[model samples]
Target: MGTWIKETDKAIYLMDGAYYLQKIDKTAHTGQVEGETFFRTGQLKTWLNSKEPPGFFLVSVGTGVSEPQPLPPPPAPPLSQGITITKSPSQVKIYQPYQVAGTASTSLVGKTVELYIDNSSSPAAKTTINDNQQWLVQSVFIAVPKPQVRNLKVVAGDASDVATLTLTPYIEDHPGGTKLNLGGSVGSGGSNRASDVRKVQERLIALGYTFANKNYETFVQTIRLFQSIISGRTAVRGVDGRIDVNGRTQRFLEAANAPQWMLMPSRGVGFYNLEVIDQPWDKHDYGIDWMSNVIKAAGIHYELAYRKNREGIAPIAVNDVSLPQGGDTIDHAGHETGNAGDLALPRLDGDFGGITWSDRRYDRPATKAVLEALRAQPWVNKSTLYFNDPVLINQRLCSRAAGHDNHIHFEVMVPPTP
Candidate 1:
């Protein structure tokens, strides 16, 4: 009952019925190996040392485990990809049952895989298979009405013998036009620059997207708008492959996802709602959805960032909130200061106790809404809001953090020191 090792496959050999045994080197003596031939000890001896093939077990045992999982019939090769909902389809309308399908190739036969729908507040869409690994979502799942988008994801198992699948339903060139370009341009309008890049990263994190510490891929991964435009994926590429979306529907959706901002008052530390950027502009623009789901009825606008630090702060100017004393302030100084953003809310928008400007209650609703939205994303490590203040944000809105009166400041605080 000795064992043998195969030079090819990196599999192990077991001496006895004990399952986890490792490979034993080939011995000069001969006997029957489980994998070579089924002959008992006598017959195996005749073949050994002759040019005859080695014993079955000695040759290579097929525990049947190494066989690659049989693949589903082929429709589209299973794609091991990640997905995101830049614009979640909250409204479920009644669309007729249309077929949803995907394909993948696997070596294993008879193995099964679990198909999943991403973050579905609804149930798992109905899934079934056509003859050759072609999979589809049955009508029961399609009962969900339309005009809204759905994301699809599939994972192969028994232990991933194949790549995974990530599928998302988006408004495919709805109403407007159609084009797909993939390139980057300098000074291309829209809030598509530094701040927006950070915001997009924030949203992706909240929706459960992982990333590396290196900035290159993070930047690319964060903004789907950019990826769509630059990677030749979405319709951002105009007819002639022009790299632009100055003011398009897809851009509108992308911008809608950008973050909204607040300013630490020009008069004092208190924060205020000045203007909203709707979305972080492109790489040269401003938009929070470009960041995360954090949103206001409007979106992000913060202090224009001053130079010198405040007490626990820094220098001056028109915080993205507003211009103090109203001088004809025009130039956007290149100093991009980053502040941490916080809100103890969930991925879904928060109905924070803080009052909004329109709410007109004791709570400073506008500031409350903005701050609460920020709290929902993983990107915003820390932030200061204008809620504590009776004026900027009504106290009613703030269930915690007292109320950010002077101004809600967000600092990108890092982990602890060893």
Candidate 2:
């Protein structure tokens, strides 16, 4: 057929019994339009039917066909001749470099491939397809606080493909074999090898520790502070302010930036679990934040029911554990972060019915037991229970709060930031 083309808002160039549609990609071009080919006729028809612009009608070129007609379905499967991803890391750590590899058609060889991450306008990476029709984007890194899924899209000209990968917090690994050992100790009264000291300083920075300088005294004090907060050695004698090769301090630092988990409903356990409960006052139950430690502590706390001979107790209920993005919810004062949540008070007869701490139906003993278990958790801030039970407060289990008579508001310890 002679020079067959269809025109509407977007121009469709039809040649050799194939249709190519051109659309504007603002990022792909300064003032030019890019043509995208639809492999199936149905897809083109759907687009044409749905996206017909106002005051626009199709203008057919030549006498090949006056109007677009539905063609018969192909007998064979479509050929493997498009851009496809062959390699991508399922889980990637934040701030760590990774690579994504894929193959394109031989016709796309020597062309550029643009990688777009999440909803960002700019491409995270770009590379040219090689002679073998293979493309690799190297040294791709993502920076985020907690664990989350990241959407990745690669576009080579008009051909595009999408992928998803888990973007986790950066957790450094312990080097294996001889690499495990540092050159020397990295602190006061130690050899303080330059390389070893640099390594320690870098890890501390990643863990959100900041120091004025790398002076010997400042480094030592920073090490001691890290020991007190992160390494769990608060005592004067316990904190040596030194990191020996393959020592406990080194191990803690290496594992400091591990991935966090979202608070989820328990799987196998019975009533002892802290399951997600509805908040009567809130519009939506936003229990989607990073509170895995709190959930785990609830399980550990309620497991004591068997030991206390209170196995028939109702499952502990939790509410309003922050939004997925960790911001203030409606009608709340302090749940702006991910690590805090509200726990329903235990009532008489082990039911989930509402009861204030002052009410006679309030099961003080059971609530007290839960408080003790929560306090025992390593991640829990021991002195910060925001429930206003007089008896428990007098007993020093929890402190008094003005509006916390109905529920207990607790916070889990989060990593320090500079």
lDDT of each: 0.30, 0.56
- Report the poorest 10 consecutive residues by lDDT, candidate 2: 21-30
Compose the digit string of candidate 1's lDDT tens values, residues 225-297. Answer: 3333222221222222112443332242243222222232222222322222221331212222222122221
Q: lDDT tens string, model 2, 298-326?
A: 45444432223445565556665544323
The clash numbers for all candidates, in the given order, read 122, 0
**TM-scores, all models, native as reference:** 0.21, 0.37
In model 1, where do residues sit more than 4 Å from their true spots? 1-367, 382-404, 411-418
Task: Indicate the residue-level lDDT of 269 in model 2.
Answer: 31
User: Lowest-lDDT window of 10 residues in candidate 1?
Assistant: 301-310
Pick the TM-score winner.
2
TM-score of 2: 0.37
